[model samples]
Target: MENNQEGILLTSAEQSYLWTTYQADTMAVCVFNHFLQHIKDNEIKSLIVFALQLSEEHANFIREIFIKEKIQIPQGFTESDVNLHAERLFSDVFYLNYIKNMAKGGLVTYGRVLQNVYRKDILSFFSACLSQSIELNSRAIDISLKKGLAIRPPTIPYLEKLEFVHKQSFILEGLGRREALTGTEVTNLFANIQTNYIGTSLATAFSQVCKTKKAQNFFKRGKEIALKHIEVFSSYLKMSSLPVPGTYEQMVTQSKDAPYSDKLMMFHFSLMIYSGVGNYGLSTAETQRSDLVADYTRLNAEILKYSEDGANIMIAEKWLEQPPLAANRRDLAKG
Candidate 1:
């Protein structure tokens, strides 16, 4: 790493990632504020506050970078997007799990950004972000474990001996001849199931409080897709005689009160949908079984369509922020 990285202009990767991080952190601040208002458990409250602090700090840090470069800072989520007095829509355990999943997303995002960015300040920022997400993720797990609410991944029996695959069918699908699920395959399958579980719970809650019929219908569709994805992922685990993880639907409450604005909720759901798509893509790559690849490919397409519909909703609502783009030489020449 060069010490004079600041002299170099920000790469497209650096600018776009910082831009996205600003939006996500700001949204997180609003969410934590709303969560803080209704949390009765002191331990969970402190964790929420810690998570909020990181988001606030991240936003401020990115704002300084934008200002120094004369880039217009995005008007990300604000206090207007959250209603502090809204009734509780989630239980304490649900709050913890949400934050855990949130940190999981942040880790993946920051890691991806770090790989593409080289500017010194941006590198430092994302490095710190990655570290903070690790801490936040650890704390969430710690709290969950202490409270006996952690969702553990399914376990497979330990390998008793070194083995080699004797058939090309190890990578192929057949009528009745298939190898057992590999550990990596199981890992991806279980992780996808867990992510979709969170999505299903959020969809359930978001659908309950959305004011517009359109948004409500969107969330209901999302919930159905999430539930279906979970079922499909769980089938693989069940085939290996592993116990499939259950849903977090019971973590949600029946409250009809809206804690966050429709726009904020919509953006939040979009973030989850995008992350879920990435998870599926990664699972497709790491998984060895042809059946798993086929399933992931099909489900990935389903969510991509859902994501496009969600983006259209946000654009219509004027809630989607435009990212930095390339200059149009044709338009410039015409002008």
Candidate 2:
């Protein structure tokens, strides 16, 4: 942690918050601008505009703090990374779904940062961010539901009696048929499926537009992984006689022209892969069924390896930024 005699220095937590927000907001600006150029739905377009404004405001506020602290601001994604005149990469519905997922991520991120932040100003800033994220999440949900675009988890029949676990089979797969999934299990499964759907679409688009063969190969591999995960999850739903959530892969255009720089696209997919792994871990914990837990565990391992490869690519390209770290006592001693 950096500190001064006057106690005006930024703590590690505050530094982390500022850095992450700057990067996220910068990426959001590029993504939102591209969406704005292609979006046709007035309702979805309005929400995107609102979200973009918030992201821009956040970027500006974080930059001001970085300037005050004399910290070098990260040159994240920018107009140079995006082409507003490029052909559409995703449909309008994909834009709405992307924002909805982003809002959920924002709420979770702000809430976690608020817990770690100790500086009064930083705490207050994250508190407000959490509030705004909540509002955006609610609005996105309302719009999605109203327009019949929300991919809700299947609802089961109401239980008539309180039942207790009678056998170990309740948590394990038995020799025979397994019981139907609980509501929490269903929710987790569907959420994972939904994320993979979005990933598949994005990876497909990137595969077609990335400049380098290496980047294109990575995107193509990611698309295959997402499709396999979706199939695995869809099978679970089908076994339960639940309707599998549909994807918007068909909405991607055939244009091979890159709308985003290769670096930006790689970073964006890396973020999605990391987020997916986190979600899978949480989903694994929420499941009591042995088979489903095993599935999540195995899939998480696959993506974890993939994410490591992505990091290596970023490092090779000098695109990966170093986050805040504690002082190196060994170096100080050597000096």
Candidate 3:
């Protein structure tokens, strides 16, 4: 709320966005670098290069802003988190899909950040990020479709007449056979299935490449959890006679070579877990079926526990970076 000769001071929301973006882009640099190691297809390689460039630029921009504000820069993931000399752990197709998924995530994240930004400079930066993510998402989708890897959702018949729900049975699932899924419900189910599929494959790859026994075991458990959630989501579509999206788990290689440090892998996996919780919560709110809601609630609870366990592990190893926090007035007074 205060400004100096330097510039307008950062609000808590603005500060949070900058800090989170800095950390995410730092991890993106390491991730794309590792992806570049095994990429054989020129098309996929170019996409990865573009993504890496954006991440680097964003990281630099945030670094300069932090310097101007005199805030200590976060020690985010860096080249030390990755090994370019490592063997290929993922196929080229997987690289393409990973970028596609990441672009989708970026779109959601940048939109949220844009809403929180109050300063003109910060708004402009996030606006640029949002535009870039839109273009990146389109490119990724085009490439995936061309490569025959895109798993589109099922199309429904056009509604001839608009009608409102009359009976309570419209939202019921306990007694009789449930009615057909609404378009919104179908979309969420398909989206969550896709998310879990990617999570499972990424976790599987990390489990193999992670350094310490603890990290490896953690990834293995994450993979199992993701697989279980995928099954649950897929079954809902199956019950509706809808086609389920396929996974890219087979794209992961048997290489045990470490492409990234254990700390980086753990942090990346934790981010995906937290994102899944958000997605599932949205899905639950959009659905009307009691059974679907119950399933999402149960899966969300499971992932919350898993995410907490991961945080504890990161804390034990002192790998978790502390976010910006308010000063403890009581502690200062005591001192």
lDDT of 3 by residue, 1-335 (tens): 11223557899998888998998899999999988877899988999999999999899888888888898999999788999999998999888888888888888889888887788778888888999999888988888898887878899899999998777777886655466888999999999888888888988998887877887788889888988988998888888899998888999999999888888889998889878998999999999999899999999999999999999999999999999998899999997
- Residues 1-335, candidate 2, lDDT per residue (tens digit)? 22222457888888987898898889989999989988899999999999999999888888877887788998887889999899988888888889888897887678778888877777777887899899888888889999988877788999999998787777868744466888998888898898898898899999999987888888899989999999998899888899888887987889888889998999999889978988898898889998999899999999999898888888988888887788999999997
- Residue-level lDDT for 54 in candidate 2: 90
Per-candidate local distance difference test: 0.88, 0.86, 0.88
Worst lDDT 10-window in candidate 1: 1-10
How much is the lDDT of residue 331 in candidate 1? 95
Provide the global lDDT of candidate 2 against the true structure: 0.86
**How many steric overlaps are in each model, in order?**
0, 0, 0
**Clashing pairs in model 2, backbone N/Cα/C closer than 3 A:** none
Q: Which stretches of candidate 2 lie above 4 Å from their native place?
A: 1-6, 174-177
Give TM-scores for every candidate, taking all chains together and pairing residue i with residue i.
Answer: 0.96, 0.94, 0.96
Per TM-score, what order, best first? 1, 3, 2
Put the candidates in lDDT order, highest first. Answer: 1, 3, 2
Model 1 has an lDDT value of 0.88
Model 1 CA deviation exceeding 4 Å by range = 1-7
The TM-score measured for candidate 1 stands at 0.96
